[model samples]
Target chain A: MDGSLAERVDYQALVLPYARSPDQDAPRPVRHPVVIVGAGPVGLAAAIDLAQQGIRVVLLDEDDRLSTGSRAICFAKRTLEIFDRLGCGGRMVGQGITWNRGKVFFREEPVYSFDLLPEAGHRRPAFINLQQYYVEGFLLERARALPLIDLRWKNRVTGLQPQGDGVLLEIETPEGGYRLQADWLVAADGTRSPVRRAMGLESKGQTFRDRFLIADVRMDAPFPAERWFWFDPPFHPNHSVLLHQQPDGVWRIDFQLGWDADPVAERQPERVIPRVRALLGPKVRFDLEWVSVYTFSCLRMERFRHGRVLFAGDSAHGVSPFGARGANGGVQDAENLAWKLALVVQGQAPASLLDSYDAERVQAADENILNSTRSTDFITPKNEASRAFRDAALGLARDCAFARRLVNSGRLSLPSTYRDSPLNTLDAEAFDGPMQPGAPAADAPVRAGGEEGWFLAQIEHGGFTLLCFGEAAPEDLPGIGGSPLRPLLVVPAGAAPGKAAGLPVIEDAGGLLALRYDARPGTTYLLRPDQHVAARWRRFDPALVHAALARATGQG
Target chain B: MLNTELNIAAPDDFYEALVALHRDLTPEQSSLVNARLILLLANHVGDATVLRQAMAKAREGIGPAGQDATLRTTA
Candidate 1:
C-alpha cells in the first residue's frame, strides 16, 4: 500500500484537564512573592525551583495542556542534570532514548561521525530523545506536588505595569478578570510573549531565508537510536535532511526547503509523503504523527531584565532549531534565573544579583544565536559563493580529515562556560580540568554513606555549599549576613571515609571527582545554589571565601 | 595545477553578474569587494598549494601589455 493512502494520519490531541481557580472568584487583588506567566517547561521549571526553596509562587498558563507536538526532543546532559535536580530525572531518563553518537553524510555517503561522550565516569548520557510534552508533564507533576506552588491554568495576563518595587498584572480568567501584584514577574510565556509586547521591547536579529519541514512519524523501522544528517542527500536533491529516533518508536525527520518554497503547499500530506517515501521506502508502514513548516530566526532581546520584570526561555530569546538550542537554552535560562530570583525574593541577596541573570544569559543567548546562525548558513548557503564554499568543504571532507572538522550541520548544544561572568572569582591559583570558577559543576560518581551518588546532587539544594576537599577544614568563615552555608566534605582515594568537622564525607574511591574538579589535597570550592563555581582556592581561606560568597550573592 | 574553476554551466552570465555587482560602487568600495571576493574564493580552494598556483597563473596576464603571456595578441 502506498504511504500516502495510509489511513489519514491519526492525530491525538494531548489535553490536560482544566479546573476553575479559586482566585478567579476572589473579590480583591492578591499579591504574590512571585507570579510567573506561561506554564511551559521553562515557567514550570522555575516554579519547581522556587517552590523547592519554600517560596510561594503563583504560576499561570493560558493553556491547560502540554505542547501538542514532540517539540524539543533532545535533552542534553546538562539539561538532564538540571531535571535531576528538579526531581524528574529518573522518569525522563527511563522514558527516553540515550544516544551519544551521531553520523553525518554527504549525498548518500557517510562523511564523518563523532562521539560525544568518550569518558565513563559521568552520571548521565550525552543526550536523550524525549518529546517536549513528556518533559512538561514531568515538570508539571513535580510543580503540582509542591505545596508552595499555586499552578493556575486558563489564566492569561491582559495587562502589566512595572511599578517602583514590583509589577502589577491584570489577568483574565474564563469566568472573570482579576488583578495581581507581584514583587517580581517572570515572562516565560514563549516566543510571542505578551509580557514582552506589553513592555514594548523588541527582539532584534537576522531571520534566515530558508525554511524547514519537520515530520514526526511512527514506524518500527530498523534504524538505530542515533542522529543521522545528510547534505544534499540523494533522496532530496540539493537539500539537507536530518533524522532522529525518539521514544515509542517515533522518528523525527527534517527537510531543508529553500527560501522560495511555498510553506502551505509543502505541508500537505500529498507533498510530504513522497518526501518521506523517498527517504524511507514507499512500502514502509508508517503513520505521520505531526507535521510543521517553520522558518527560524536567531533573535534576542537587548536585555533580559527590565525594572522588576524578567524574561526567560523563548520570551528572552529564540534561536534556529538546528542545534536543539531553543528549549535546551530556555531550560538553562530557567535554572540560572531561578536561583537568583529566589535569593532576591528571600531578601538574602541584593536585587542587583538579578542583573547577573541578564549579563550571563544575554551572553549565553548571543553565543547560541551566533552558533545557530553559522549552522543555518552552512546548511543553507545564501549566495553562489557561499554555496561553492559549502560544496567544497563537503566535497573535500570525503578524503581530508581537516575538511571534516569544517562541516557544520549542527553543532549540538553544549553548556557555555560563564568564565568571564562578573560573579566568577578568577583563578587566583592555577587549576586544570573543566571545573573552574563560573563553570557548571561537573558531575561525578562517588561513594556517599555506603551508596554511590553524584557530586552535583550534593551542591544544588537552594543554598551555598562549601565543598571541602581533603581533611583541612577552614573554620568560621564569616557569613554573608543572611544566607546559611552547607558544608560537604569530599575525601580523595586512600583517605578514610570518616565524618570530619560534622560534614558528611564522600569517598572519591576512583579519584574521578578529584580529577574532575582538579582538587588538590586541601582545595576548597564555594559553589552557588545553582551549582556554578563561585570561587575556589588551593586551601581554605576564610576571609577570601567570605568575600567571594558576598560577591556571588551581590552583596559587593 | 590550480583549479581556478567556477563550476557554473553559464560562465558568461556569472561573469556579467559579478562585474555588475560592483558597477555602482566607488573605487575604494570596489577594491574592498574585490579583496573580500579573493579571500572568499581562496577560502573555498582551501589547499594552500593550489591557491599559490592559481595566484601565479592569474599574475601571468597582468604584466606590461607586450610582455603579458596570456593577453599578448598578434595585431
Candidate 2:
C-alpha cells in the first residue's frame, strides 16, 4: 500500500493504505511553519486547525491507516464543538451515535442516572460514540482537503534536535530517511510518544492496576442509544460493566477484569462470550468485531511546550479511559496550541504566548487526570473502607436522590474553563452568567444575514471577535490598535436588522443567545480566536476592549 | 448551624427503629446501613453549614485531626 505520489493523496486513503512521500527526494531540508507528528485525532486536529489559520502545516504519520480497533469511541460535546470549528462537526454528529443519558446499576437494579446535557440551545449532543477510526478518517479527510497541509504518510520521526529558534527533525519514510526543519513542532504522538522519548521527557503519574476488556460486538440488540453501566451484576458479580451503542450496528461492551486477571486470557472468545451472554441473555446472537484489553494511567508532562517543540494529545497528557478523557482532552490540547502557535509563527504575537498553552493545557490535563483517577478509584476501590463507602452509596442510591451524587461511574467529560488563565481580562463590569473570562463560549441559536446559524459559528471564523449585545447598536466600534478585531452586534430576537450601521448584526433568536450569555440590554463580550470569552462588560468601551485585546494576545 | 441539640421529636422511638433496622445484620452490613443512614440524614439536612458542623461533631470523638480521616479498615 506504499506509493511515492507525494503530490496528491487519494480520498480513498480513508481505506487506510500507506503511501510514500516526496520528502525523501528533497536535496535540502524544507522548513515548514508547523510540523505535526502522528496523524491521529489530536495531530490531525492540530494540523487542520493550523492549516485553517493559513499556516503551512506538515502532518506526518508512521502509518496511513486509521486506528485498527474501536478505541476512544466516546467524543464529548466540547470535542464535537472543536471539530465544528475545524469544519467537520456536522459530519461527526451525523455519523456518530449521539447520547446524553447514562444509567448506573447496582447489582441487578438501576441505582443512578445522569443527563449530561439537560438544557437545550447547544449545537451538538452531550457525547457521540463514534469509533476512533471514523474520527481519524474524517479528520484525515479534512486535513487532506486543505491545500496548506502537507500530509506525509509512512513518515516517522526518528530523531529530533531542538534548537533555540527551531527544531531539526530526522524523518524515516518508506524511501529511507530525510531531514526537515520546522519553525515549530507539534508532537501529537500516542502514549508511547517517540518524540518525547527522543527529548528525554517523561509523562509521569499514577497507574491504576485494574484492566478492562473491550469487546466490540456487531449485533442488532434492542438497546436504546444510551450509556448503560452495571456494577456487581448478578452474572458478573463483584465487577463493573459498561455498554454503549455505536454506529454500524456495533455495540461497545466493557468488562472490568480485575487487576490480577491475565489480559491474554480475558480477551479470548471463551472468556468474554460467557460474560456478554450473562449480561445480554443467551438468546441474543452477536458477532465479535474486535477484542482488546487495556490498563490505563493518568499522566502528564511537567510542561507541554518545550522551546520550539510543543506536545499535544496523549503525548502531552495521558488519562484513563474511565471518563473518555483520553481523546477528548488531547483534541482540546491541539485546539489550545493551534492559535498561539499560529500567532507566534506569523509574528502577530510574541513567542511568549505559547507558554500560556502550557499553563492552560497542563491545567486541563490535571483536571482530566484528577477526574479519571477519582473515577478509577470509585470503580475499583483499593481499601475496605473505600469499598464499604462505595457500596453504601450505591445501596442508598436505590432510594435516595442525594446518594446518586456519590455515584461515580464516570464524570464523562467537560471542557475546562481557563478561569485563572493569564490571557483572560477579568470582568471589570460585573455580569451574571457562566460566560466568565476564559470560559469556553457557549453555543446558542442566532440569525445572521437572514440565515439562522449558531452563535459559536460566528466567532469560530478565527481571530479576536468583539460581540456587542444591545437594542441600540453603536453604529461602529473603534478597533484595538495593531490587533484586528471583528465586532459583531447581537440584538434581541425581534430587534430590527441592520442596526449596527456597518457591522454584522446577529439576532439572538428565541432569546436563547441572550439568556445563555445572560445578556443585558447593552451587554458586550470579547471572544478569543479559539471561541473562549476574553472579557465582558455591561456596555461597550473602546479603552477596555483595547486593554482586553492586548491581554488576550499576550501583550498585557 | 447544625441543630446538634436533640432535633428528633420521639428520639427514643427513632433510636429503637434505627436499632431494629440493623437487626439480624452482620457487622459489615450494619456499618453499611449506618453509612447510608448518615448519607440520607445529611442530605435531608441539606444546608452545607449544618452538614459540615454535623461532620465536625461526628469526627470529634474519633481521633486526633491528622490521623482522624485515615480509615483503619485495612484488609
Candidate 3:
C-alpha cells in the first residue's frame, strides 16, 4: 500500500471500541511502523525526523495537555544547527535571547566579564535562553500538522511484550486500554523511564548532597541581561546566587540552598523575598514568578538501546544543568539516532549500525554528565574550609587572565567530538594542534587554493566534508561506494564553494590535510545527520569505512 | 599554572588584598573577578563541609548591614 494512502487509513477504525467520540469509546488497538513513548523534545524530534522519511509514528504521552513548565532554557550552538536542519531553527533563533557574555561576581562586585563570541571566525549563535516549553510548543504544532504522525496525549505505555518481528505495547489511556504494535519503539519518557525500567536496564549514577532553589522573578530594577554568578558571603555563603535575564524583563535566579535548608521553608515567598531584597539592596523591588527545588544527579543508562527499542534524551542519561548540556545532549542523541533508524526502516542499512548509536552517544553523554558534575561540585562546595579556599582562589584569579578563561570555558556550553573515533583521521603531529577531531573550538582558516572560510561553515551543510590539506582532488580520495548519501562539493581556495547540486564544499588557501565532516562520517563517521563528529580514520580505509557505512545504514 | 606570588600570602593578607583589589575594580569587573577567585579557592580546599559553612556565613554578610561593613565605605 502507498504510504500516503496508508496515512489516510483511519487508525481509529482499525482499533477496537471505535465510537463517535474519542473519549466515550475505548482506544482501538493500532499498529504503527514506529511507536515512540513520551511527547517531550526528544520523542517529538525523533518522530518528526522519521515521519519526514515516510515512516508512520504514534507518539504517546501521559500528559493530558502540552507541558507548560519552562524546564530547559539554554540551547547550545550545535542544538541550533539541529533545529536549522529541521527547518525550525529560524523560528527559535528569532524568539530566543542570544547571550554572548556573562559576569561573575563576589558579593555585589564583578570580577570578570567575557563575550561568548569566539576570538575569531563568524560567531555561531552563542546560547539561546528561550523557555523549553516554548520550543516544545513550536515542535508539537509542526508535528501535528504532518499527516504521518499521530500524537496521542494522555496515553501512557503500561506494558511491553515482544511479539514476532515487532513489539506489542499495552497503553493505558483515559478512555481505556489498547494495544500498540510497532516495528520499533523509542523511549523518550524522561529520567525515570518506564520503557527503560520495563526492559530492566539499570541507570547508574550518584546523587549530590545539596539542593537548590530555582525561581523566575520579575524585578523592577535594572539587572544585567548577561548570565551572572554572585558569590557573596554570610547570607549566601554556602549557596550560589546565580541569575540570568530572560527575553522579557523576567529574571531567573537560582539559589543554592544549604543541605539542611527545609524545602517547605524555602518555597515561601516571605522567605524568598527577603533574601532577594537583601541581595539586590533596599531600592530594588521584585515579584516572585515561580519557585522549585532541584537536586543534582549524574547518571546514564547502561545502554541506549535494547533490541528494537531504543532510548533517547533523559531516558538514556541525566546530568546536572550547569552547562545546559543535559537537554542539548538528549536532542543530539535524537539527531544521531533518527536518520539511522529511518534508513533501517527503509531497508537501506543493517541493524548492527544501531550498536554504534550506543557506542558513540553513550560516551558523549558520559562526558557531558562528568563535565556538569564537576561544574556543580565547584559551584556548590560542601565545607567551610573548601568555601574559604574557593574564596581565596577566586580572589587570586581577580588579577589573572588565564584563570578567567579556564573558568569561563568550563561554564560555556560547546560541542565536543570523539577524537579517536574510527570514522575520523587524526593528524599525528598536529594532534596537539588546534583541529583535534572532538574539540569544538572555532574552525581555523584552511587555504586549499586561495579561498577561505571557517572550517565549520565549510562542513555546516551536513554529510562527509573532505578537507584536502595539499593539492589533492576529490576524485583522488575514495568515492562513496554504496548508498545514496550525497557527497559535498570539493571547495578550492579563493572561489566561494557554491552548493553543487545539494553537496556544498569550500576550498582553503592554507593547505591543511585530512577530512572534516559535519555529521559523523559513515564508512568513516556513520555520520549522524546532524554534523557532530561521530567517528573517523587517518586514511581512507575502504574495508573499515564500508563496514561502518553498512552498519550505519543498517545494511549489514 | 599556580601563581606562587599570590598563593604565598597569609590568609588575612590575602583577604585584605582581595578587598583592596575589589575596591579598585568597576562593579561589572569586580563580580566576575571575585567569583573566579572563589571557584579556584573552592577547588583547592577539597572539603565540602567547611565550604558549606563558609558560604552560609558569606550569604548572611551579603545583607545590607553586612555588605556595608565588608566593603570599604570610602570607596
What RMSD does model 1 have?
Answer: 10.1
Q: What TM-score, to 2 decimals, does candidate 1 have?
A: 0.86
Name the 10 consecutive residues with the lowest summed lDDT in model 2 chain A.
A1-10
- lDDT tens digits by residue: candidate 1, A1-556: 1122323221225465557766656677677899999988899999998888878999999877778898889999989888888888877888789999999999979999988898988889999999888788778778878999988888889999899999889988777788888999999999889999988887877677787999999998999888999999999999999999998889999999887889999999999999999999877989898899998777888999998999999998988888889999998999999988988888888899999999999998988988998888789776654676677677767787766887898889988788888888888989998888888888888888877787777666778888878854445432322355777778875577443755567878688888888898778898888788999988877778788888888886
- Alpha carbon lDDT of each predicted model: 0.83, 0.85, 0.64
Structural similarity of chain A in candidate 3, as TM-score: 0.81
True contacts kept of each: 0.00, 0.24, 0.04
What DockQ do you compute for every candidate structure?
0.03, 0.21, 0.04
Interface RMS for model 3? 17.4
Candidate 2 similarity to native, TM-score: 0.91
- The DockQ leader among the candidates is 2
Q: A1-556 in candidate 3: lDDT tens per residue?
A: 1012212222112222222224224365556678899988888888877776677888888775554545688888777766655656666667677877778876656777877764543324678887776577667756877889887877878989876567888878666777777888988999888887777776777766777888877777576557888776455764678778765556788888866789888889888887777667888777787687787678888888788888899988887778888778888888778877776677766766677678778888878877886676567654444444456555655686545544421365666665544434333322233445444433446543344445554454333333322223234243652243434333444555432333334454443323223211122232434554433444445565555444334453
**What's the C-alpha lDDT at position A41 in model 1?**
83
Best by lDDT: 2
iRMSD of prediction 1: 20.7
Q: Give one digit per residue, the lDDT tens place, for model 2 in B1-75.
A: 766578789999998998999999998888788777777777777899988887788778686434211222100
Off by over 4 Å in 3: A1-29, A233-235, A401-410, A420-483, A492-528, A533-556, B1-75
Candidate 3 global TM-score: 0.73
TM-scores for every candidate against the unseen true structure: 0.86, 0.91, 0.73
User: After best superposition, candidate 3 residue B9: deviation in angstroms?
Assistant: 20
